[model samples]
Target: MTSPRINSVSIMHYTRPYIELARLEKPTGSLLIFWPFEAWGLTMAAFRTHLPLKYYIPNLLRYLAAAIIIRSCGCTVNDIVDRNIDGNVSRTKKRPLPSGRISVRSALLFLVVQYLVGIVFFVAFLEGLALRTALWQLIPM
Candidate 1:
């Protein structure tokens, strides 16, 4: 059996690059995008009559989660598209994609997984709230 130090080192080696890949290490960009949209959505949602804190609070938390997922997705896509460009820039050269920490294909796969997980979370939250759109409204005439 592997020792604990070796196990932890292997885990960090495998997983640490993804933190930079997802932009979690620098969250100001995500927060900038998350807070304003969240504020606007919460404000609009609050305008509805009789929205108790019990209802609003859970939804608020879900929205926050969604914002973080979306921001991560945006960061991933940007990294994918700008990998070559980022390599040329001093500030971004050490990013996961540009720095050879992760392969392009692996980064793309990670992005797809992130999107699927985000979709699952969204569907679960909506299902929990019984939110739905009628089939008729979705059909084009």
Candidate 2:
């Protein structure tokens, strides 16, 4: 019992850096990305079409998940790209990459993993043009 508890705590400690790297602590970014594009659009469409609760609720959940993943990916890319500049900045100096809590190589791997998950999610839950459009959104303009 003691050993398992210690291990779980250790795992959480190890993941802290990655979580910060992905900006999971601050969810405003995710919500900002979600509401304007996904949430409102879906809500209006469901209202107009009289879509059933079963479909609307599940789709909303999926969009929420996508928003989180997409925001995480964007933050990781920003941190990786601005690592050097961030180290010299006052506000961003303590970020994971700048603070040396996470290596660039590790961050890149994490970013790739995020993109893969996003792709798999869109492909699995969406179809045809919807799938293509969702996948296209994953690529930065």
Candidate 3:
């Protein structure tokens, strides 16, 4: 089957290299981002019998959200930066940047929006009580 263009893919995204790139291509970035929080929650429960971690759950959620957004942001940035190079390589020659499926301007604007979400996540983290709970890592297993 012929590869679909990026513009059409957004309507109902699925398995594709660009989207997969957004998902970080099986890298451990998202895991690394989320595991510490889950571990902290469980370990604290193990160590401190009474410190309820319900408060930290929101931040855990935020961390997961950030992982996904940041990974997607990284993917967009990669495609943006590598547009010309991707156009040259046969494997990537049909990617959005080369095939005119998505424009450079739109790609850049989308990236800016994603980074803004990162800023919001950071700001929320700073002001959130959920953050305080995560910092107090429990005793090592």
lDDT of 2 by residue, 1-141 (tens): 354455777888789989999899999999998999999999999999999999999999999999998888889989999999999999999998999988999999999998999999988898999888877777764
Model 2 scores a C-alpha lDDT of 0.91
**Least well predicted 10-residue stretch by lDDT in candidate 1:** 131-140
Q: Tens-digit lDDT track for model 1 on 96-129?
A: 9999999999998998888777767766776533
**Global lDDT of each candidate:** 0.76, 0.91, 0.63
Best candidate (score: lDDT):
2
Candidate order by lDDT, decreasing, is 2, 1, 3
User: Looking at candidate 2, what is the lDDT of residue 60?
Assistant: 97
Evaluated at residue 45, the lDDT of candidate 2 is 100
lDDT value for candidate 1?
Answer: 0.76
- The clash numbers for all candidates, in the given order, read 0, 0, 0
Rank by TM-score (best first) = 2, 1, 3
For each candidate, give its TM-score against the true structure.
Answer: 0.78, 0.91, 0.57
Give the total clashing residue pairs for model 1.
Answer: 0
The candidate that achieves the highest TM-score relative to the unseen native structure: 2
Error of 2 at 130 (Å): 2.1
